[model samples]
Target: MHTDPDFSSRGRRLLCGTLAASVLPASLAPAAASAAAGNWPQKPLRLIVGFPPGSSPDMLARAVAEPLGQALGQPVIVDNKVGAAGSIGVASVARATDGYTIGLTGNGPLTTAKALTPSTPYDVARDLRPISLVATSPFVLAGSMAMPAADLRGFLEFAKAQGDKLSYGSIGPGSGSHLAMELLKTHTGIRAVHVPFPGFPQVATALMGKQIDLSFMIPSIAVPQAKNGRLRLYGVSTAAAFPGSGDVPPIQSALDRQRFDVASWNAVFGPASLPAPVAERLSQEIARILQTSEVKQRLLEQGWLAAGSAPGVLAHKIAEDTAMWGGVIRLTGARAE
Candidate 1:
C-alpha cells in the first residue's frame, strides 16, 4: 500500500509530480474556455475507461464525470471497455469518430503496453489526441508477512535465493505494475515467477492471502492497506517519497543501480481527429473541475493527486513516456502475457 506517485513527462517537471503544479502558470496554456459547446459536444459525452470498475482509471473518470457534465451542460457517461491490459478500451476511444467520445487511461496502454505487444490496438501518437492528465500515483513494491524479508535489501537477497520458487503479481501483462517488477528482476537478477491479475484488488488479495509473494501495487489499492498495516511495503518505484509518509525508499538505492522510476497516471484523450478548439475547451474545463475542493479531496482520499493539465502537457508526457518505457521494455525484455 502507498500514497503518491512520480508522474513522467512535462507534468513531472512543471507540476513537481504534484497536482499543486496546476497553480503554476502554464504560459503555454490557451485562454480558459467560457463554454464547452459551440459546434462541439452536440450531445452527451461518453468517457471511456479501459479498466474495470473500481480501478484507478475508472475512479478518476467517475470522479469528474458529474461535475464535468454540469460544466458542459451535458451528461458525461462513463463507458468501461475492459481487457488486453487496457488497450481494448483505449482503442475504443481512439476509434470513435464522434468528438463526444474521450477516454481516461493510464501509462501501460498509452505507451509501454503497446511496446510490449506490437499488436496493441491503438497507436497513442497516431490514433489519440490529448486532453488532460487526471492523476498520477507511484507504485509500491509490497511483500507478504510470510516472506522472510522486512526491508527491500533483505527481500532481494531472499528472492535471489528462492528463484522461480517465488512469484510476483501484476494487474496485467503490460501494465506499469508489471514493468516495475520486471525492471526489478533485471536489477537484482531475481528469478521470481510472474502472475497476472485482472486489477489491483485481486493483486492485493493475492499478496495478502499469501497466494503470491510480492506485487507492485497502485496507490488506490496499496495506500489504505499500507496505512492499516495489512501489508508490508519494501520499496517504491521512484526516488521521490510519498507526501506525509516516509520510510519507503526508491528501488534504486537498494540495488546500487543508476536509476529506477515507475508510476501510473490517468489522463483524458479523444480520437486523433478531435479539433484543437474542442480539445482546449475540454482541457480547461477538466482542469477546472480537478481543482475544485470537493473533487480534489475525493481524489486525495484515493491516494491520487488530481492534475488537470493542458492538452499539450499530456501530449508531452505521452511522447516522453513512450520513449522512456520503450527503452526499459527493450532492456528488460518485458512482454504481454
Candidate 2:
C-alpha cells in the first residue's frame, strides 16, 4: 500500500488551479490557456469509456454526448475501450494529446484500481486533469431473500454470527463494490469470504439464486427486483436516499455509524496537457447540461444523481477517495489477483 509522497501536493495543485480559474477576472481567464483549443473542437470529439456499451458509465457518456454536442456545436462520439477495471479507457484519455479527447469514468479506474493494482498505465494525479464530476450513486448493499437480516443493522449482526461462513460478491477484485464491502467490515467487525463476479448482472443473478449471501450491487441491477421479491435490499452505502431505492435508509443511519459513506461516482477528465480554457469550457458546458431537467431525469432513470460541479470539485473528490480506498485496501489486505 505504498503512496506517492507528492500525491497530496499534486492534488492541491489540481484543486487550486480550478479555484483560480473560477475566480480569475472574466477577461483574463483564458490568457494563459493553450491555443490548441482556440475556436477548437472543429471536428467531432471522442469520449473514451473503459466499460462496455450498455454499462452505466457508457450510457452516461452517451447521455451527455448528445446535449454536450449541441452546446459545443460539434458532435461528441463515445469510444468504448474496455479492460483492467476501467483503467484502459482512462489511460486512453490521459494519453490523448489532440485536446479533443476526454473520458467519462467511474471510481474503479480513477481511484480504487490504482490502489489495488499500482502499475496502471497512467497516474491519475499526474496524467489526467479532471473536468467535471458528473454524478454519484451509492452502492446498494443487498442480500438474498432467504437471509435472516431484514435491514443493514440486522445484517451486520447476522454477518458477525456467521463469520466467514457467509459470503459476499463484488463485480471484480479492485472495484468500488469490493472496497465498499471491505470498508464496512472495518467499521462493523464482520467477516465474510469475498467472491468476485464479472459485473452487477452476475451478482444480481447470484443473489436471486441464493448462490451468495450478500453483495454490494448497483441500483440499475438491484432496485427493480423488489417487485419480484427475489432478493432483499438492505440499505444504501451513502447517507442519502437513492432515487428509486424506496425507504432504504443509509447504512450509516441504520446503526448510528461513523464512516460508512462509501459510494461509486462518475466524472469527466481530459489529458493533463489540455488547455485550462478548454477544460473550463467543457466543465461549464457539462454543468449546464446536467442542470437541465431533461438531463437530470435521464440520469435519475439510470440510477444516478446528476452532480455537475467545477473541475476542482472532481479533483478534490478523486484525491479524497483514493486515500480513503487505499486505507480500506490496506486494512483488508486486498491485493490484486
Candidate 3:
C-alpha cells in the first residue's frame, strides 16, 4: 500500500497544530484544534472497523458505538473495511487527522500485520494514537468430536500420532488465533497442516462439520457448542479459566506443561496527532461506560472482560505484543497470503 502525499502533509500539520495548542491559553487552544475541545464532535462520528460485520471486533464496536455517541452528543457510525488481515481499515484511520474518524481494532492489524508484511502502510506507534483498551477474551483449544481426544494430554498424543495428517483451522495468518496455535506447536513439537478461514464463525463451522480436526476458538463460540456436544474442548489457552466456561481448567493442568497465555484484545485508536484533550475525554468516558453494571454484564455474558484501561496501558500493550508476535511469525514462518 502506498502512502498518500496529501495525508502526509495533513499529518504534519495536525502534529504541529497540536504542539502549538499546548502553549496556548485555554481560551485560545480550542481555536487551534481541528476538532475544537468545546465542539469537537460537531458532526456524526465514524468508527471504522477492520473485520466484517458480526465478527468479534465488529460486535465489540457496535456494543460501544451507541453509548460512546451518547456521551459525545453525536451519532457513531460503523464503517467496515475488510481486507489484508484488517490492515486496510487500520490504514484508513491512520491517515485521517480529524478526531471524528477513529478506529476499533484488535492486535492482529495493530501489532502483527506489519511484521508479517513489511509493506503494510501504517505504523501503529507512529500513525495511530491509543485512546483506551476496550475489552479482552481468551481462546479455547477445541477438537472435533471425531478426534476422540477426551483431554488435552490425549489430544496432544493424538496429534503426535496423526503427525502431518492432522489439520487445524485459524481465522487467518497473523491473527491471534493463528499465532496461539503455532505457539502450541512450538512447545509440543507437534506438526499439522493449517487451514485459513475468514473469521471465527467459519472456523467454528468447519470444526463442527469435521472439515478440520482442531482449532483455537473464542469462548463465545466454543462454550455453547461444547455444552451441546457439537465440539470437544481440550483446554483453554489462557493461564486462568475463562469466564463462563464451567469446570474447564487451564491447558497446563491437562498436560502438566507450562501454560500459554495469549489473549485477544480490542482497543480504540485515533490519528497519532489527535489532541490531548480529545483523547483524554474519550478515554475517561469509555472507562466510565465500561464500569456500568449493564455494560459489564453484557460483555461478561458474551465471554469478554471489560477492560477500560488508560491510553498508556494500550500503548505499552501494543509495543509488547508487536515484539512477542514478531518472534512467533519468525518461528512459524508465516507471511501474508
Best by TM-score: 2
Q: Candidate 2 local accuracy as lDDT? A: 0.81
Q: lDDT at 282 for candidate 1?
A: 88
RMSD of 2: 4.1
Ranking by lDDT: 2, 3, 1
Model 1, which residues run further than 4 Å from truth? 1-41, 153-165, 209-211, 227-229, 244-247, 252-257, 331-333
Top candidate (lDDT): 2
Off by over 4 Å in 3: 1-39, 252-259
Model 2 quality (TM-score): 0.90
lDDT of 2 by residue, 173-238 (tens): 767788888888877777888999877889888989999989988887788885579889989998
TM-score per model over all chains: 0.78, 0.90, 0.84
Writing each residue's lDDT as its tens digit, candidate 3 over 128-211 gives 777888898888888888998788787888787887898999988777788888888877877988999988889999999999
After aligning candidate 1 to the native by TM-score, how far in Å is the CA of 24 from where it should be?
A: 33
Give the worst 10-residue stretch by lDDT in candidate 1.
27-36
True-vs-predicted CA distance for residue 55, candidate 3, Å = 2.5
